[model samples]
Target: MESQKGKWWKKAVVYQVYPASFKDSNGDGTGDIPGITSKLDYLHSLGIDVLWICPMYESPQIDLGYDISNFEDIHRPYGTLQDMQDLIDGCHERSMRIIIDLVINHTSELHQWFQESKASKDNDKRDWYIWRQAKYDDQGIRKPPNNWRSIFGGSAWTWDEATEEYYLHLFTPKQPDLNWENEAARRAIYASSMEFWLKRGVDGFRIDAVNMYSKPPSHPDAPITNPSMEFQWAETLYCNGPRMHEFLSEMNEVMSSYGEIMTVGELPHTPDRSEVLSYVSAAKKQMNMVFQFDVVCIGYGKDPKFDVVPHDWRLSELKKAVENTQGLIMGTDAWTTSFLENHDQGRSISRFASDKPENRVQAGKMLALMNATLSGTLFVYQGQEIGMVNMPQSWGIEEYKDIESKNFYEEVVKTSKGDSKALEKAKRGLQYLARDHARVPMCWDSSPQGGFSTSTDTWMRVHDLYDQINVADQEKDQSSVLSFWKTALKLRKEWASLLIYGDFELFDLEDEHCFVYAKRSDCNVALVVLNFTKKERDWKAPKEFNGKSFTLLTSTYSGDGKPGELRPYEGRLYVQV
Candidate 1:
């Protein structure tokens, strides 16, 4: 077995907190750092070792906190610097580590650096961000530098009248991509932004879009994927560019200077395991692990970013995604991450499991079981433990607050020319795939405010199902998803050697209804069986373990149902006896 000795993170389970939606402290309708500090005990109770808080840096909120304006300080709505320190202290006091999000790939246009960079052609900070001359047509009409499309849609190069140049923005025009090639800019990002937080006692960071740091050597028109759309998805042209590795390694050096810090990169829409390992392998010294997009992007239709016609991800494909990812860094010094939901994607309960009233609880527990058994470090997004689902039907397109969702919907509107049916279809697409589904306020109870804030309303609307699905309500029922999560985590901690670093052996790969696997440590083996479908499934153990006796460690159901039968969305964990 791989010796993951003394590595706290190898055995640690992470609970991600989306600050604005976690809990509101001062009743200002926004969850803040103080609010996170207030819940330290609750996180400890959930048995998580790390609390990974999303971006809380100063910003215009154009793309939420991802477009950081002042990384050195905290955002006003989030809290002051002292409050952030107190939060770090509180988590440490509870024996839990704290890791804040790092989002330096881009900066808010309102940022001091960007403001100066765009002020004139001769500004010292002009080269800190990407800037290019505008193209001209035969008629002498101005055009963007290339046909590159922003991840948020529209032209990647926004014409900047102030500087008489076009600036690159992989996202919104308000978020200008940083020129990592600039030595001074890289230095400032490390010393002023990264070290400032590390010196203040943050354990590490969940690096935001680390793979997007380097841009293509030259921007050229990409082949049209959507003929009707002018700008095309130029991800292949820019993602994992030539300098991507060099940049991440440089960033890793800064992180390593702070000692055994934990870092997990966000590698969106990349499923190449070999390429991912190059970033996480200890020899490479880039990251501890990375969040792979293969599993979560399974159901995406045409465009992986915004799929208008989403598919219901199948069990067989999902099983392969998990197994393939686990094999990425198995014996190597690198590791992968196990997660189904995050601030970027919709909830696992809605997408991976059934959210129907009769099945939600069981499905939630089953997913927990599946994640806890994976070889990588486990991460649970906020509201996932309690099975919070997608936004309800009553929510119109106007209710969606995510910039990406709104922009994508607007694109659809423009293409359909205000057709009612097309508009509704677009809204439904967003409902299934929007980030707001995961960004909704955490439901603490059945209160009108969903127990998130003292105010009557929140920054974003709380999921209306909060009354039916909440922490307080689930806490009362021992069979609840929350209780099962605690149980699963406790068991995982107890059997870390077998569950975390054991050899992963998958079974029944072609059995579309069931995902079966075993974690083996020498002669000791732990088996996991999950029924992905709603109907009951008759499962047969692999022949290699046919005669072995096993003890049930934890399960989604109250009763041990028939030995060979698994009820809809049921999960079972067992250790060889």
Candidate 2:
């Protein structure tokens, strides 16, 4: 066992794999654990130290795998327990760690626990999930238990006629929020589900919607935000509620007994810096890292109500967010998980780059450079290295699998009396701007189905650019985006003292199109510069440092000159002499 002494996550790079779309070994048209096991060599070659596999627990496929039916068992579609063990062994053999998704915040209604809970009022498991009597007003009109609305665009309270009560579901009705206020419920969940993996030697857990574990004691109706909507649920009071830290600390203590395990919380709506720090601080005794959503807000403008359209994020704003989080963690015991794209986000290529093919590759490389150099643990979503773009515009509504996309399309396009063409155009914009764009299948080869499966059909449509953009092709090309990523990961690991745990300082340059930052460790100094716009731009090093010797580590442009000029979307990294 590794000693629990210092921050192990500081130099780690976690790769998130959406197993359902990773690969198919039995040609079942669905990615299974066996498929993931077969590809362990590929992930190992990519320099991945940790693999964060999304939920493969038993589910009915609602909300994909988020609606977990059995926390302790693997979903049949994914494979059996032996398959999971084989994957763990495979990863461990390569010195890689595995972090499974823990979705204890909710469970599928089909789960035995939930089934028993909703059976009767006096049932032993009746209080396992949130349930309350409907409210009655002076006029004798019945109302939902709370004004909270579901994240999937409906009332959070679903009427359960069998129990004569309303149950709470933050997301789809099939997934009812577990009653964390009940100690027995919490213990049962952690002991049964969490311990099952820990005892099996799984490295850690990436808790899903972790902050939503606790809710307000009094089920008050949420205030109205949209009058036209039938019900409105304000999430402020419920999300990140009080007692969250206490619950997390207890959970952490249980995990601590196992070994030097990693814990990452997926916290949403972390209000400001202080709240963010508290969740990740060493004193919190909760988690090693927390993935905050602040960086995802980059695409949105200053006005909160402004419509979301695909646009370029200013280099300064990106620098500020990175600096803010880095400053909070630096000199402290806490750490962060930095990423440009994940399963819940659109591919960074489509979100941050121009639609042109050439420009997308350049932008992808630059973004990879910027993200990999940040002072924190890095995460690379599947296909990010190959610069996968959004699904093509030709896809129709029927072809979409994401529930959120379908709901939004119906609300924004169909309700607005838009035609099919208008809806398709709106969907393209949404895909380019929304989170679903990143959930497409991993592009491994140019073969049919992108080499993900040999089946006649896939769970989700593979990106159309799979032919030109894939791991197999890029692995052979010296200048491919995939190669650049491999190099960047090697650089990070090789220069851990300077790149991983070094001090970060943002450089102030007159050009808004360029991003400049310096990493310093003792006497060693490295500067990273990125050109965000088209056309070349020349940047001058500090006047006093003009004579300093420099070594070019990597550059997107081929030729070199003093204070080099960057080509469109080009980026460079230099080590000071």
Candidate 3:
């Protein structure tokens, strides 16, 4: 008997599609809702149960679609509201759920609320966004009210001469932070924006920058690490403030009325597991789950992600992070979102696999197997199915389109005055943290524009290795990475009772290069093992199972059934017979 555990979303798998990079239907060199509609069958075939489409709301394109200008309408480039409805209908037709990105943490400066708020200090909407008076030093140099750094770069505050006050923009200056402190603003987001989509049949929302919605009562300066550098910290004050729970509870009250919805928040630099549990526990009445970056960000060096050091991570450390994160809410009502690559990060195969051609496929399959067997809703980003790698080293900074990536490079140059060493370091940072690595257009086939678009110029260049890694080639090969993902998802669904609800236990097998674990329940026991390095390793059956025979359910290396030795980059799921 499998442990009695059930949740609609817990049994479903989600696939994230970066709208601008997914598919281009009209030769505009940009992806739109219609483009997505054209690919519904393709998505359905992948066994994906939920489609998490990134923001398509009307925007100024300042920070890609994250800067929403109109919460109720589709961006012109993405198509009309009718197209969105049609996409929703199409998804529903194929028994797939649609969840849009809810980017309420901030809105484009072009949004009506910000426009009126900036029109005059006395305007009724002035408090809709965080506004503070400028502080003048003894020398009469006007500075921001507090020292807070923008995540993109530079000061978090931007001077607005029209109002003679500065406004907070934690991201790009064009994306102003909303004042969640105001109850009315919260109601507007909840009633007018969120309700519009929920009523339109969107199954749920993936709340963007959910923690940044709350702000501290006092505006305080972050401790300055280096006077020359821009304000280094603002997230500490704004994320998960004292009133955050109150606001979330209020929103949850409203969301409960919507009926059977799944919500996940984007949480970065989270404090600890307890805080996360508070937001996701069934009793919390907040979101259903949250996306945390503790495991993925582990490779950052001295400069927290901007460092120029070559990437390095040990398998033991990765395993420890996973175990810790799993320990936080495992077997509890709270849940976590499991993902390896998303729009903001580099491709996983490139970041984790050996450079040799043979290892890429095995490594990709290994990652899929490990993530799929984990006790959470799995999220697969586009192109990950084909084992996509990072853009070639030849890509210059000029070719990148990600606002954050470009801003980081510019900040380094401005601080270092175009010094050759500084420029090289900046390049290294871009190569590692650039969002464009995952935003590159999907490679459907080995045609011009990789069959992503008919236009000669795409928004971003396609990956150079598309010829070998395109979906067309992979779909034809039963042993390809794409096929492995299909198998993985199907197997996860088939073993939902064991894989989804079974208690996870780490194996005592001793090998630095191997990650070993098991999921156990009354009726079944499944072993998940992976070789994280480029050298072969031994997978010694545990002492209790030494004399028993295990059947191979799936293997990246097509290992011999006895499994005394595992191949490089090998991964396997086995069931005791």
Candidate 4:
């Protein structure tokens, strides 16, 4: 029997599947729920305990599935409610939990609520979303109520002539921010929409853009910085507002009544550590964990061009980030959702490792080792296990579907006098950091269409190297990256007490290119050593560590022994005697 005190997320490894590119069962040229259901066996084989499906909600697909049109229904292209229910049932049958994306902060303008709200000023649902009359100066020229800029490059407010008021949108103009200040709206969203999924037996949710749920009552405009573009408000004033904890506590109270549900919040601009800790604290009635972005900003520096290269981040910095979290928040019931790559970021293989096949394998193994050994719930994006890298420049900007990339090209490149240079710079910027890097289809086999779709033309182009870096090809080779990932995942499962729940200790290995750490429980200890560079590095074991006998749990390197030499990009995990 599972422990009653045990939370499912405590030991879970979640696999994030972006549905549109996962697999296509009906040859529709687009992936659907049935396609995902057909691949449950593959996910199970991957040793994943939880599956986090990105938004498949009803939408216009403007920002892909993020711009939700309906809270309770599946997108028509994906499938019906029955299909969603079937997928949930199937996952439960396989002993895997399912977590759907909850995007309550904003809804598509096409949503019934928005439509009704915009129809008339006296509509019952008018206050359900943020709406305000345009501000006019003495000159009588109307402007947005506030000077807030949308995340997608425009004013945050959009005017509706019928209602004669402007509504707020933090992101794309089509997605209007909900007014959580209204009690009726909050209660209805929580009870009617979210509860609908809990009733359907979904394990929980990975709330999207969770911090933007509320805004300050002051409605103060932001200070201007750039003359050419509208100023971005200091997000802290509105985001993670005064009543955030209260609202979350209510949400948590409702969710906690259910059995062992997990809630992970995506906080865009997190305040101080203490403020963040309060939301995740076990004492607080909010969420199980929160995804932190400190690690994601490692490559981003003051100088744009200087930050573009894949170089080694100081292990000391990594150690400090981990230590800071553990010291301030780890033991206090607030946990973290640890990851290297998600749909929003570039692939770890491309971001952190060399692009060469040999180096890619080692880098993949090392990165996995680092993440799995951290004191948080682990998350692996699709194709990460096979060390999938970013797309090459073979496809032009027209082939890309990411809205952010398109906006950058059009707004920054097209408008610039140095059009050719600007376009090249924009392409380079996208080549490394665009969100589309992870949206590429999962490479299942070496066949045409990367075995994702049976149709001649897919919704998106498959990475050309799929033939050399697919699951079918890697499964047969023991030395393959996929096999290495399987071994590492199995080891993590087997040694959960030490690997998953243990305290982390960063070893002072004193090697610039090497990352070494240890996980310790009361009775056992495990050491993880990784060489992030292409040069061989020799590391000395600590003087107190006298045990020469150690079992190699997993390694990117070929051989093992005393004074072991780690090849370029190699990693190893050892169970100490």
The candidate maximizing lDDT is 1
Instruction: Name the lDDT of candidate 4.
Output: 0.80
lDDT of 3: 0.83
Instruction: Go through the candidates in order and give each one's C-alpha lDDT.
Output: 0.86, 0.80, 0.83, 0.80
Runs in model 1 lying further than 4 Å from the true structure: 304-311
Pairs that collide in candidate 3 are none
Which pairs clash in the backbone of model 1?
none
Q: Which digits, one per residue and each the tens of the lDDT, describe model 2 over residues 1-577?
A: 0122255666788999888889888888899899989988998898999988999888898888999888788989899998999999899999999999988989999999999999889988888999999998899998787778787777888888776789999998889999998999999999877998999878999889988887889877777777777777566877778899899999998889898888888888775878878888877788888887767667753311124556745667766777776676666766776788888877776666564776887888888888888777788888888888877767676666877667667766655688876566566556565556777778789999889889868888777888988989999987888888988999988776677767788877345788888888876888888888776788766564578887889886556744667788888888874
Q: For residues 1-577, what per-residue lDDT tens digits would candidate 1 score against the true structure?
A: 2755568887789999999999999999999999888888888998989999998888889888888888888889999999988999998888889998988889998889999999999999999999999889999999898999888888998888777899999989999999998999999989877899899998988988888889875777888888877788987877888899898888888888788999888887576777887888877878888888878877766763555565456778988888888888667778877888999988788788777888888899999999888877899999989988888867888889999888888877887799998788777778777898988999999988889999976899878788888989988999898999899889888887778777788997888899999998866899999998889999988999877898988779997699999999999999994
User: Quick one: ranking by TM-score, best first?
Assistant: 1, 3, 2, 4
lDDT of 4 by residue, 130-247 (tens): 9998999899988989888777667889998877899999888899999999999988888756898999999999988777776888789876655665556557566788788888
lDDT string for model 3 (415-507, tens) is 788999988977876776577899999999999888889998888888788788888989999989999999999998888766766667787
**How does candidate 2 fare on TM-score?**
0.94
**For candidate 1, which ten residues in a row score worst on lDDT?**
304-313
Winning candidate number (TM-score): 1
Of 3 and 4, which scores higher on lDDT?
3
Any runs in candidate 4 off by more than 4 Å, and if so which? 1-5, 137-139, 223-228, 301-319, 325-330, 508-511, 543-550, 561-564
lDDT of 3 at 54: 96
